[model samples]
Target chain A: MRDVAIVAFAQSNCQRDAGAQNEVELIMPVLTEVFKQTGIKSAQDVDFTCSGSCDYQQGAAFAFVAGVDALGAVPPIKESHVEMDAAWALYEAWLKIQMGSAESALLYGFGKSSPGELPIVLSQQLDPYYLAPLWVDTIAFAAMQARTMLDSGEITEADMAEVVARSRNNALKNPHAQLKGDQTVADLLKEATYVSPLRRHDCCPISDGACAMIICTIEKAEEWGKPYAIIKGIDHRIETHHIGSRDLSRSVSTEIAGKAAGVANGPVDVAELYAPFSHQEIILKKALGLGDDTVINPSGGVLAGNVMMASGLSRIGEVAMRIIRGEAKRGVAHATSGPCLQQNLITVLEAK
Target chain B: MAQLAAVVGVGQTKYKTKRKDVSIAGMVREAAVNALEDAGLTWNDIDAVIIGKAPDMFEGVIMPELYLTDALGCNGKPMLRVHTAGSVGGSTAIVAATYVQSGVFKRILTVSFEKQSESNAMWALSNPQPFSPHLNAGAGGYFAPIIREYMRRSNAPYDAGIKVAVKDRLHGAKNPLAHLQLPEITMKEVEDSPMLWEPLRFLEACPSSDGACAMVIANEELAAKSPRKPAWIRGAAMRSEPTMYAGREQVNPRAGIDCAKDVYAQAGIHNPRKDLDCAEVYVPFSWYEPMWLENLGFADEGKGWELTMSGATSLTEGGDIPWNPSGGVLCSNPIGASGMIRFAEAAQQVRGEAGDHQVDGAKTALGHAYGGGAQFYSMWVVSSEKA
Candidate 1:
């Protein structure tokens, strides 16, 4: 495969409502930042542009078309979109580069999760005939998974609370984080349950946000004279949709994707995990076989502030930023979609 | 470096106003199974799955591919979902082809569909947003002004739209799977149709359809092992521009023109009219037949209607350069699937498997789709011979 690198990244601050600011307003700032960082102007600078977003996030048909306003795609520019997280958009852009279709690409993801009932809105992603009609919230689905692990002696409520505590503590250093507080596991465990066996603190905060990034060939990285992170490997895998068909406590798909992404090829100095629920962080850590050596979620991860479509790409961006800042030499990023993490994507990034 | 890719299999469900016999998953599976069978492969042999649909409101299933991965055999495999407005179908195919063209996967399954009957598409489409109030004008109402402007600029006869309506419906009649089979349609019948949008008769607009289309794309080595002939992919391109900008041309969008130019350039075509044996352009409205003709370089600016006046686009008289021989969107428009149908039909013609809708001796063809008020454009060129 052709060598591709992450040259620039930017994101909006996580907000509860972002009132009056539509999708375009939420996106333009990040786009402007990435453009400035890369010393490029508009979509014309890149050979391709791809976005990751969902219509359900906005509750309108063809809602994603409105996002094009942020790009000012005049005189027309090559572009595509995925009804997925921006990490998948990066995957597509990576393939475009490898295929020699283009030398550079701009990728973005955005969502306003505050507009609707976040968990209930996600119920529509379930099997329509079997599960969605019943209106089971996604939080309940994750709760069941957490309970499964709890009953199996895999983890305790304190362990889950500790993960949340670590995430919030890590957010102290992350200025973009929406929720950040220094708290002990005992303090987190004192909170009441929002869903059975799961405290409200264990779940990610619903926030409105958008993120943008630009990637280019390795040669372009040097020509631009900017620090970059090489994407050493990336892969994604999915499990059966039937929630009852597999054990919710284990992430077979994440393990398979982790293997495919070649995460073990080198020492992982830092890892950005997209575990919206506290328990999922432990599950992914086990699935990827990461020991205490890998420092997880230096940016507090999505658990501190979840931006839906943007969070996955944020994981990638967060890790790449660490590499660019000379904080870590190598890292891993993960993104998930569907109830209880039915779909998972893993990417391995390395500093030059 | 990019590797070669080819379309070795194509499949579709019968175009209908409503597919009540099966659920959404079943509907997509029908097309997938048929495609796999056509390619002489099974679900286990596929390496990845890429699906596309216009919007979740059409079926009320947000990211339907999540629920669909099982039926597609995507377990422990990469599954990507694409959404690019109405052009998503074509864009999805482009993304799927890249998995192979990039030498990442040997075989991939790509599918696009729209179950418009599951929910009210018109209401879903006009859902008011924070910045814009509900106009309540459906797609036709939105495009009527553009159609009128095209007529004024080109000086097209009042009967130009009527002729295209009758011509495509007749082509639809030849295909058994078409939703509206009007083999004996006439100009008088079209003229009497209700005028929903001024100068646009009810018959001139495409019908809402419930259908799905699927294709199996493979790398050079896997495609060479296929039982049937493969449609060699020459070029694929996509373009987008901002909507409602000042001094922008809505009738003949720059995005469409640029997209066509990019694809034609990759295919080594200096003149589209002669290089392409046929075309399956997206024409939801009859007037687009002429508008796109000029935009796609098939005709000169302001002179595209002459080709229509001379019956040059008709399969019977157009000889080698027929457009929408399979009746097209007007005959069966499952919105999202419509674009892939155009793409699959292009592949079918080159593979000599289009049945009755086949353009005689078609060796090269173009598949085109545009979406989001004509700001998003995706097109591809395919030939019987390798690029």
Candidate 2:
């Protein structure tokens, strides 16, 4: 396979509400920023374009179509899209570059989670015939898993609060974070619960945002590189859609993807994980076989701002930024989709 | 760097304006089963499933793929959903094939569909969002201005587009699966058709059809052993550009041209008009046949209309590069599925399976689809002989 690297990255601000700006309006600025910083003058120069987004966010069909205007897509360019997160879109583009079909590729993902009742909207991702009809919101589902973990002594409310505290404290340094403060674990534990066993702090804030990443082959990577992180390996896996079919407390998909991407082999200096819910972080860490010594979510991660599709791609970008800055030699970035991380993708990036 | 891929099987649902007889799951299954049958395989033969559709609003279902897992026989298997506006069908197929080309999955089932009967496509397409003014009504509303630009640039006669509409509709007569089969469709009738968007007569545009198209793709080895003759995939390419940009050419997009050139190079075709036996190009509107003909390298700049006028795309006329023998998108369009239909039709022609609309002696064919203001493009070349 040909070498590919994340050459540039940009994103819109993470916000609680996207009042008038829809998906397209939200993503346009990010597209410009990504290209502007990369010094790529023409959209025509990009060989392939791929995106990660869902139709539910816009409450409209073909929501991604409107995004074309943002890319200045006239004079058509090779493109593809995934209903998954933008991180997976990046994976697709990486494959294209590896196949030698494209020299450089653009990847983006966005979602406006504040328009309607986000928890209710997310319920639609459940099994349509069975679980979805129950109208169980995401918090309720997470609470149930939390209860299982609590009963099994795998984790505690105190541990959950610690995760929340550490994540929020870390977010104080991130300018794009939607939530950040120096709240202590004891104080977080005292917060009111949105759902039983799951406090507001335990859940990722509903965020509206968009993000873009540019990747290229080794030669193009050199052309665009001021600093870029090479994607060493990337892979994704999906478990059964039936929620009850698998153990809810474990993320089998993450394990599979991590193994496939070679993340399970050894230790990594940094890790960026998409854990919208606090307890999910614990689940993900175990699935990925990360030790306590590994520094995770140095970029504040999704717990600071959960922008659905964009958060996943942002994880890769965050890790790549670290590699670019010479902060880390190797990093593992993971993204998840579906209920309880039913689908997961992992990418291992390294500095050459 | 990439492994070769082949279209081992192809399938499509019977095209219609409303497919209310079955649920969304049933609709997808119809096409998937047909594809499996063509590949001489069963549900277990597929290692993964990739699906595409225009939008959630089109069918009043959000992220319908989650609900459709069982319908497409994706249980305990990898499933991906792709959405890139109108060209999603084509892009969806490309992603599925990539799995095989990347040597990840041996056999993959890719499908695209839209059930327009469940909801009004016009209203869905025009559904106003926040910030953006509701200027465009439907797809035609956005494309009409581009079409007008094409008219001015080409300096083609007004009758040129009307002729395309008449020809495609006439071709639709032979396609049992085509939605519009106006046996007496004439240029005079198209000229009299109602104008929804300026310069775009109603009859010249594609009808909103409820349909699905499915294809089974495999590696060279599996394809060679398939029960049916495989349409060896010579090349596949996709491209995209921003929808709104200063100096952006809407009439003949650079992405389309670049995509065509990329795919042709991969297929090792230097002269498309002679190298390709036939083509199933995406032409949601009648005039698109000639426009895309030029875009796809079948005609010179500003002379694509001449090919349409010369009857080079007719079904029985035996034109060198017979285009849309299956009547094309002007006859039927389930936005999400339209691209795959072009691909499936191309494969069908190569397989000698297009019963009535079959172009005789078709060996090498091109399938093309574009969406999102003509920004997203997905195309492929298939030949009877393996490369």
Q: Which one is best on DockQ? A: 1
* Ten-residue stretch with the least lDDT total in model 1 chain B: B312-321
For residues B176-201, could you state the per-residue lDDT of candidate 1 as single tens digits?
88999898888999999999999899
DockQ each: 0.87, 0.47
Candidate 2 lDDT over A12-96, as tens digits, reads 7789998888666888788888888788865667887888887778676667767766766555556677887888788777767
* Weakest 10 consecutive residues of candidate 2 chain A by summed lDDT: A68-77
Measured by TM-score, how close is model 2 to the native structure? 0.91
Error of 1 at A198 (Å): 0.6
Candidate 1: where is the Cα deviation over 4 Å? Answer: none
Task: State how far residue B305 of model 2 sits from its true place (Å).
Answer: 3.9
DockQ of 2: 0.47
